[model samples]
Target: MRILIVGGGVLGTLHAWQAVERGHDVVQLESEPEARGASVRNFGLVWVGGRATGAELDTALRARVLWERIGERVPGLGFRANGSLTVVRTEAELAVAAEVAAGAEAADRGYKLLDVAETKKLNPALRGDFRSALWCERDAAVEPRVAQPALRAELARSGRYTWKPGREVRHLSATGVVDDRGERHDGDVVVFCTGAWTGGLVRELAGEPPVRKVRLQMAQTEPLGEELTTSVADGDSFRYYPAYRGPALETLEAGQPQSKVAQEHRMQLLLVQRLDGSLTIGDTHEYDQPFAFDVTEDPYEHLAEVAGALLGRPLPRIRRRWAGVYAQTTDTGRIVHRERVADNALLVTGPGGRGMTCSPAIAEDTAEELNL
Candidate 1:
């Protein structure tokens, strides 16, 4: 089968790789010479453990293994298996995290609930008022901007997939799809992996899926030279990836710690030390009808303050800031199966704010579906 994947971000590159693995000829068409969305602008946490709740836990574990395997296939793209620490500072926060841990245990999850002393032992750089934490030992992080392009290069080097950059696809034709230049290229399967830009192509299909465009603001700090290993999430970071809290937020009620915290501030700020010693953080979500990828630092100061409180250290000076737009579905879990588009084409989209970590499984599923 000849499969053409739309959008050159994480999903596009992943789909192309999976298709080639399934012995199908694949080409990924990216609008820009480089990715311009959430694919590059993210904390890059593979998120194996903090999301230790419900069926999603199992799915996350699978994604974790998939990430490790992908890392083995393509070395260096910053696939760090340092796990994640959901730190708790206050007694109330500890209580909430304990409940999350209990629920995860009831669900038979693979996470470790650690005391503050134990957490500090795991990552010595973290020093603050934290009392306890939930650790996902299998969690990993990847440098998307670097890892993704590297994956694409490896695919080409192995002679499996082809990537076409600066090839903005315009529309789908009866027999083929047209590019920005109105050039039509036919394929056995045409999949839409356009992330936030998916609506423009699938508007006429009446997709019942409630996919929305969300703007995420992220920033980086000057190099700290600290051995910061794992991804860290605090109270203000939940709005972006609520899966970290599991069903705790789902059943959170009035006057509850998490409920009150969530109402006052949509999320807790998260921090992750990149491979180069600089900390990457931020990420406040704002919805837009058609999202734009421009960043603002209005939220970073507060975010930095929270991170400083978490670390018990002065906040590092900001070096750069960026905003990326992502396609998000009302349902939190990832979308894997093919969407039944008119005629025979499938509109494959993953809008769970994790197009990179979750893309391998989705792409593999897409390739198998194309075989059918």
Candidate 2:
């Protein structure tokens, strides 16, 4: 089978990987010289512990295993099983963590309620005051910036994968697609993994998928000057992840209101260390359309304050700040929005934040479904 993959982000690259691995010839196209969407702008967290029950959780676990395997094969991925800690500072937050840690799926999720001493011992860099933390051993991280190029390089080894950049697919034809260069690339099957750019060809084919665009703010700071053994999250994260929803969570929310700025911007503090000793920290969620043209300063300030509290020191000077948009299915239960846009072409996207986490499994599923 000759597979034509559109988009050059992680999802598209992974699809190309799956197709090539299955003994199919794949030609992947990208609009930009490189992917500049949410794929590269994310924290590169293969987050698993906070996923909802059922398919969402199952997909994350499968992706985590797949990530480790691929990381071993592709050393440039910079993958590590460092895991994550959602630190709790108050009794309310601790109750929420304790409840989830003792739940039925605790073992599967690697959920353990760690004491202050245990948490500090696990991540020595955390010298701040905190009661306890929810330890998720299943969580992991990868270097997002170089992930796609690294995967593509490995796929090229198969001699069946061809990558075409600086090509914006103009139209989908019966056989394959026609690019802006007026070149026709023929293939047996076409898969559109277009990221957040759903305006032109995407809208013309799928007619507005149930997916919505999400805008987020992120920043990279100067090297922390020390190792952050594990990824860190604030207790506020519990309010955002579906897995943490319970009576205790409800109680915590009612009793402990979020800081004004955090509530206003839908913010959570997730800190991860890059391979270069720098810390990648972010994220405030802005759902409504017409997102701000520029990054807001308040969210970054809030993030710095929370991160400093967790580290017991001032945060390093921020070297860069960025904003990105990703497509997500409005339905919370579904992992992504997939549909057959044409007889020979299928459109798979809207994995949302799961794009970085579950892309491998998602691409694998696409192959199995298409019998590639």
Computed on alpha carbons, the lDDT of every model, listed in order, comes to 0.70, 0.95
Clashes of each: 7, 0
Candidate 1 weakest lDDT stretch, 10 residues: 253-262
Q: What are the runs in model 2 whose C-alpha is more than 4 Å off?
A: none
User: Considering summed lDDT, which 10 consecutive residues are worst modelled in model 2?
Assistant: 329-338
List candidate 1 stretches off by more than 4 Å. 50-55, 104-109, 204-209, 236-265, 288-298, 331-337
Candidate 1 local Cα displacement, residue 236, angstroms: 4.4
Tell me the tens digit of each residue's lDDT in model 1 across 160-207.
577788888777766658888777778877887777665555665545
Task: Give residue 246's lDDT in candidate 1 (0 to 100).
Answer: 46
Q: Please write out the lDDT profile of model 2 over residues 204-294, one tens digit for every residue.
A: 9999989999999999999999999999999999988899999999999999999999999898999999999999998999999898899
lDDT, residue 36, candidate 2: 90
RMSD of 1: 3.2
Residue 169 CA displacement from its true place in model 1, Å: 1.6
